[model samples]
Target: MLFNIINNVRIICAKIVQIAKSGHPGMPLGISDLFSILWFYFYKINFLNINSINKDKLIISNGHGVLIQYVLLYYSNIYNFNDIINFRKFNSKTPGHPEKNEIIDASTGPLGQGVGIGVGIGIKNKINSFIFNKKINIINNKIWIINGDGCMMEGVSYETTSLCGVYKINNIILIYDSNNISIDGLIVTYFNENIRMRFTSLNWNIIGPVSGHSYYNIFKAYKLSLKSYFPTLIIFNTIIGFISPCKSYNEVVHGSIFNKNEFNFIIKNYCIKYIFKKKILIDNKIKYFKYFIFFYKKKYFELIRILNFIIPKINYIYIYTKNRYNCINKSTRFVSSVLLKNIFILPEITGGSADLSASNLTKNDFIGFFKKKKRYRYIKYGIREFGMSVINYGINLTKTGINFCSTFLVFMSYMYSSFRNFCISKIKNIFIFTHDSFLIGEDGPSHQPVEHLKSLRIIPRIIVFRPYNFIEVIICWNIALKLKKNIVCIILSRQNFINNEIKFYNVKNIIKGGYFVLNKKKNDLIIVSCGADLEICFICSKYLNKYFLINIFSIYSSNLLNKQKKNFKNIFINKKILFIESSNDNSILKYKSLYTFILGINKFGKSSNTKELLKYYNITKKNIIKICLYIIKKKF
Candidate 1:
């Protein structure tokens, strides 16, 4: 039966690649038996209840081998055969890489992320077990990651491996596919590291050098890993593209397409009859799996009840709003810290910064630090930006909680890949980027973000919130909570914002992404700004009040502003709009159709105070007034 399944998988891989006329066939062919053993015997999953919280996670870190996963899902009756037939087609669930909201829990394409993601899920599981009173380990599901030679080489994976060891995170099995072949011919050409020694030094229980083709060896490793008390690394020594005619075990066939003749030759080389039962019968057979069905139903209700408790009550928002109104003039991070203290009613809200908790103001006073020795809320992720980010995404996959990570805005580039993965996965996670812009004075150019806001804005489905004041922070946080699936980048200021009395401070209007602070049906000119720039706009508005009927908008999100209806967005576009921003990037230019001017710096900032930086960059009320006067004189 096992032989039959492996042979069927080989056949499926050939067919999918042949049909798509594209895709990496080597990894799927090489790792067929490993996947067969995983899904058929040990991997706990019911196709009918794929969303079961208790179901073990299977992350294909080497997503080039995604075809093997698709084939398994099809054969196991989790996905229809139609999905297989339409592999890599537009609108099909079977993309080249595994996408989230599908059978796969975490999206895996960019190598090494799945390792970090697995660690995150494992951490979440351990925390959840504590949440369930420690008596019943309801959320203890294994996070199985299948990483290839490429994944092993990636630095992100190594970082996560060390972290898992330091924290002693368990229920994580990282299977290293040591095929020893890369697109460049051989891994030994550029990569050489003692795998077992490295993992041993990192404190991971090493379980391999196992034969990939042997079911017994794989089973024994899995059994030993389950009984062990820490993260396990099972290294599988296997031949790349084994048992195929089209360049079998050849580096040249890494991502090569197979022609009909080549496909036929490969099938013939396998030389196995296709005698598996039909899909309909397979589906029916799974329904009769007594143990799987019972646990599926039990976990379904358990998750629902847990989610209900985790979701904050409506009154919390009201109370949170009231607290925001009473907030004193302070740095946005200080306000965030105060608000965090009041709004941590939900137990699932857990996270910490990369050793910038004091600066990022992410440490919730009520929630204790999440120590590895005990289950708590915050994780003191000491300076692991990349690891912290991927883990945040992983924790979100658990569906038991929401996670937020914080660091200096400039350091976002360090963890950009993880953010890209989050975008690809369409996971709802919060990222608090503090010390935004040149206003984070004296930290120098290295710590200031100039193009970072523009870079974050371009990512699809990501909401970049640059709140101007205490009220907008609350509004943006409210929106972040309500959003179903998106990455919210809350860009904040280091300097304290001037507390100007907001006219018509309706919090609901903040959802529109941009709202008029000086509500006007008709105006000679409009001043648009965001974050710390709002203070300049307020001053500029007063200076220009005698010369022109001015309208000012505190535009928090450029993406959200563009999303507004044409008539609504045109209100600002109809007038002569002057955009004021600290960064040189003219992101707000997209919203206006009229002849508009932007006041910003196109160069890096120097180490100085906020006043010096603002003046040096001409991001001042004086500059705003001069520009407005020049524009008004030219128009007249």
Candidate 2:
């Protein structure tokens, strides 16, 4: 039966790819044997009840070859043969690679993220079982992932591998496809590193040189993995392009489609167990493994959903009051620490920093670092930014809790690829970035973020907030919580800030994402600003108001304001708007119309005090006054 499934998958997938004229057939053929073994014997899943959390799941980390899974989906009666025929077509559920589906929890195409996502899913289950195991049987399951040689070389893979080792997350099984061939050529030419020594050193349970083709050896290896106490990495030695007549064990077959002659050879000789007489017909599919459930798990699942959130020591009234300041005039990060203390107290919110907890203001005394076998809440994600982001995406799929991670704003480049996935996948994680711009003195230009604000705002589905005051900070947090569908980023500052007047701003207006502090029936100019830059612009506006009737509009989130701009067009369109920001002005240039000028940083900042950096970058009061004059002179 397993032989029939394997051969049928190959022939069907070959035809599916042939129809598209483009699809990876080599991996589908090469990895078909192990895949068949997993579905028929090892993996415990009911395709009808795929949403159930008690069964084993297969995470295809190397999604370059996802046609194999589509074939399996067809066998289970989840997708008809026609859906398989329409693989990789627009508006079709079967995309080129694994996207978010009923079976696959997370979308994956970029290599190495699925490894981290698998670990992330395992991490949430581990934490939940640790916290609430005695309360109920809280959804225990194992995460199995397959990665090729290409995934092993990716730096994000190493980051996640190290994180998995550190956490000792034991419920994960990693299958390494040691085919030694990538798209370019044999990996031996560039990636000849020893997998055994490398993974063993990282504290993984290693089993290898197992026959990827031989069902007996693969079954024996899986049995050993089930008995292991640590996360396992099984190295399967297999042939790339396993049964293709022309390009077996060759890079050409890795991504290219088979020609007519080569495919004919396969249909005639290799497809012995199965015959392609008509369209690939799916069986009743009881052959795919199923675990018996005596009753529905909805009751036990709800037991783990604990909600014990409490208001902070600082009164909730004061947070929403007319004077929402600590009165100490502390830094925005300091202000953030107060909010994080309350947010961390919530049972479901897990967070940590990428080795910058002290600086990122993520240090929590309530729930300390999660050590091996410890019931602590904080996850010490030590310096791995990309790994942290991808793991958060995995955690999001669990649907039990929301998680967050933090780092300096400048380090966003490190995790950008994973961040893009976070937005694309619509993963909910509170991404906190401190030291928002060049304000962090002595960190040098390398640590200062000039275009980072613009970079984050431009991503399609992300909501970026750079709040300027305490009320706006609270408002951004509230707005983020309500906008659960979008991933939210809170950009913080290193400078001290206080606004007694800002606290009196209407909560209703602030909730709209951004609003004007001073607006009248008539005004000469509009000064748009946000974050630390807003404070300077506000002060400068007060002085400029004597000559020009300036209206100050503070934007908490550029994207959020963009949505509500139909009512606020008078503030920008057909008017001379002077945009002031400490970072690059490109983020605000989207509001450009009529006659507009941006008195903002366009170059990298240097190592210096905030005052000198301000002067050098022309972000000073003198510069603001000069720009305002120039804006008034410019014609519409």
lDDT of 1 by residue, 1-636 (tens): 668778889888877888898888888888888877777766776666666667888887888788888887777667788998898899897888865765777657888888889888888888877765332445567888999888888888888888888878878988888989999988898998999999999999998899998878977877887877878999998888777765877897788878878877877776587766423211213343344446566554555655653454546466555766555567778777766776676666887899998889888657777774446878887778998898888888887867788999899998888877887777888999998888878989988888888888888889999987777777778778777579999988888877554757766667789888988877877888888778778877887887688888888987777787788777655567788887766876666545688887788889999888878888777777888877666552
Tens digits of per-residue lDDT for model 2 on 127-164? Answer: 86676554335355788898998889888889988888
Off by over 4 Å in 1: 277-310, 314-326
Cα lDDT computed for each candidate against the true fold: 0.79, 0.77
In model 1, pairs of residues that clash are: 370-378
